[model samples]
Target: MRNIYLIISREYLERVRKKSFIIVTLLMPILMIAMMVAPSLMMLYSKSEQKQVVVIDRSGVVADNLYESAEATFIREDGMSKSEACNIYNEESGIFGILYIGEVVDARDSVQLITNSSSSMLLEESISSQIEAIVEREKLKEYNIENLDEILAKIETNIELATFVNNGATEDDGEMESTSTGVSYILGIVLGMLLYMIIILYGQMVLTSVVEEKASRVIDVMVTSCTPFQLMMGKIIGIAAVALTQIAIWALLVLSASKFVMPMLFTPDIASTSGALLDGALGTVTDTGYIATLFAYLALFILGGFLLYASLYAASGSAVDSIQDSQQYNTVIMLPIILSMIIMMTVFNDPNSPIAFWCSMIPFTSPIVMIARIPFGIPTWEIVTSLVILYLTFIAMTYLAAKIFRVGIFMHGKRTSWRELWLWLKE
Candidate 1:
């Protein structure tokens, strides 16, 4: 017990004290948040010099509807031929484009944009769509309906859907559990991928640490005082603690940035730009407590997943003397994790599908798939059952892996095989 404690202490402190850890722990949150916000920020602040487009309107009806926008100014040139417009466009100094509307009003292909320089897609689409709308509105007038403009204006509508979950609502609003499957899908995918990354990273850390220790004969000195099970368990737990610590710190820093730093970063105009988008997002969230619950489960799953795999990683490490030799084992360990990601992708469409349900219930894939399902809402029994199965499987796997570890650490030099591992498990 004392030896295990000492090993755990050594493992945890050895990693946390590194310069790399400190720098990454501090910088990663800021980088991630910045990346998330950058595109929106660029769109909000980006500006283009107003383009001067000379409009030669052969179909005079269409030109009346075209208007000046932030990106462009349309100067109406009447009674001008296409060749005349092109000649003037070639002679002009500041004209960005010459837009020529053709004699045929109904042909969509007749309108041409003649530009010397490359044109923006936004400008081209805006012109094409506006002209199309004008033509459609004019064509509708041929039906001779009374007050057609007013009728069209009155009929245009956008629907806001308020989603309410009717199945097994246990929260404060027991009768109506409000939720958004879209929000659920986004949150689920993000959290699932996050868990996958953490498991791969920290699980590999355990395996590599074990391999290094064995290669240098440090495990030999350490095992004299500790049982193989104790040593393996200690490494797994200690590394998990380190991973949790790093994640916890990242969460704190990110939250702090969001709360205290974000306001300063988002100017009044910028804030207003994303205001309705944010409101729509927040409106979809029925219960604030549900998000809190996910984070809690996320912690549990991360621990369970890492511990479950760390045993195999440690055993694989024990069976080998070098990091390169661990490649054969990586494919086997990674298969379940990879499958969980594939299952997670499909959970976006149907979280409660038969395949998703079975995958989430299975202990091997549950850690990733279950997180993806929970955001869409799941039965309490299901999550509890999944966790129980996952941890129980972790215990069973650890026992089997320890058998390999106990035997493999001393068998150094030659490569280990699946048959040999099977024999060790039997012994």
Candidate 2:
């Protein structure tokens, strides 16, 4: 126990003192904050320069109704052939494009828009809608409807649906307000991605540290003072401390930026333009209880998931002499993580589905899949069961990995195989 404590202290201090660790810990939060803010900033600064488009209307019915906006200016052409217009108009002369409206036999296929480059879909849609409105008005006039615009306005409907959750109780007021479906899906995806990245990033760091020590024969010198299992545990726990520290710093940075910086940067106009993206990203801060629960689950799963995979990674490092040789074995560890990420889409679509439930229950995938489900609200029993299974699996895998690590550390000048690993484990 004393030897393990020494090892843990050494490993933890060695990594946290490194330049790379400090750089990554500070840089990551800045990058995350930038990702959240940059889009809104771009939208705030974005100016839509008005485009000049020439309109040649053969039908003469739609021209009077075609209006201009800040995005585009409409220039009507009379007695100009398409060939003549194309020959004279230069993109350098500030003519964005030309819209040639032929006889409207079918509005969908008859309208042709020619541009110097590819036309904007938004511009095309706007033009098409205006023409359609004109046609509708003409048809209504033919029917002798005196108040066509007023009747159309009266018929238009914009419905806003309010969402609520019903808490099953005998009380009169059982319904509580719930988040939108989009908000829920976004939360799940973001949390799932966070889990996946942390595990992969720090887990790979553990694997690399083991490989470096083995390649340098540092393990041989260290083993004189401690057992293989003690060394492995020490390394895993120490690196976990580093991960937690980095995470905490990132959390503080994000909180500070969202609370102080974002307000100064995001005006009402910018927030309106960004719509729900900025809202959803910052919404978690308002719900302190939810945030607490989220971090709790994150902490639990990250520790279990990291320890489980870190053990295998340490064993993989011990079995091999070089980083190049670790590839074949690394695939074995990575495949399950990849599968979990792919299946996360299913969780987003239906969190209560059997696939999501089983995936969350499975130790290999539970770290990611379970975190994905937690944001929307998961049962207490399920969270407990998943955590229990994950930690138990970690313990078992650590023991198995230790068996391999004990023998593999002394191996040299030979390639390892599954048969050899099995022999090591059994012994």
Candidate 3:
């Protein structure tokens, strides 16, 4: 236990104190903040530079509501033909764009947008959609029905129902709970990306570390002092602690950045209409108490998940003599993770469905699947059961990894097969 602790401490400090660690830990938040803010700022700037399009309405019907719905000026040239409208549109200099509406509206199903600037794609699409909406509304009005606003409002209904056994209501009403859910969603995505990054990054680090030790003949001396079992265990645990410490620092940086950065990127209108996208990204926020509980569970999940996989990765690193050899073995460990991420991507919508339930229960996939579902409020029993299964699986995986590590680390200039692995496991 003391040796493991020493190993863990050494590994953690060695990694966290590195220049690469400091640079990445600091730069990730700044990059993420920039990514979040840049798009919104671009959109706002584009909105300010609104283009003035001239709509040359040759259709008497579409001209009926062209002025009411469009940001562009409507020129109703009823007497003029398509050729005349085209002539006028081509000659216009100050016009930002020209929309030529044809007379045979059924034949000319297309809306031609002639724009000089390439940056007006969004504005052009908006104008086209508005024209379509106006034309539809005018056609409806021709049938002697009024209350278009009410009809449109009804069409735009997006009510989400929360399912329950009894009279239980949705927990989204509370600001903190809503905030926490938002937080959970963000954290869930972050967790997935973090898991992917850590697994690949640290897994490669372990492989290179092993190769370096082997190349320097350091492993031979180290194996003489400690059993291969102890050596491998120490290495795996040590590297895992390093990963955890790095992730912890990143979490802190992300939290601090979010406090300032979220408000700047997400407007109140976007937050409200988009329904707490940033909040969901961050994860559940049930006051300070629930936040504490949620974060505690989250930390545990991350630690357990990381350690479980890291052991396999370490074992994989030890199994092969060369980096190229490790790639084939690494796939056996990585395929499940990739599949789990796919499940997580699709699990957000109807997370409590049968697919989600089973996927989250499976130890190989649960960590990602369960985290994705947490924002939508997973059952307590499901979480508990999944954690238990994961813990058990972790024990089994680590034990198998330790066995493989014990044998593989000592063997050199040799390739291993499943039969050999099985024999080693039995031994």
User: By TM-score, who's the top model here?
Assistant: 2
List residue ranges in candidate 3 displaced over 4 A. Answer: 31-48, 68-94, 104-110, 117-125, 140-187, 257-295
lDDT of 1 at 80: 81
**CA-only RMSD, every prediction:** 4.5, 3.8, 5.0
lDDT of 1 by residue, 112-229 (tens): 9899798998888888778887898899999999999999899978765656667667557556654555556667866898899889999999999999999999999988999998
Q: TM-score ranking from best to worst?
A: 2, 1, 3
- The count of residue-pair clashes in candidate 1 stands at 0
Candidate 2 vs 3: which has more lDDT: 2
Name the weakest run of 10 consecutive residues (lDDT summed) in model 2: 278-287
Q: Tens digits of per-residue lDDT for model 3 on 75-97?
A: 45566555655566553565565
**Top model by lDDT, which number?**
1
Per residue, candidate 2 scores C-alpha lDDT tens digits across 62-158 of: 7778899756789988578777777766677679888888877246656777788767666778887887888878877998887878998899786
Cα TM-score of candidate 2:
0.85
TM-score of each: 0.80, 0.85, 0.78
lDDT of 2: 0.79
Ordered list by lDDT, greatest first: 1, 2, 3
Candidate 1 error regions (>4 Å): 35-61, 70-72, 75-125, 158-186, 257-277, 282-291, 349-352, 376-380
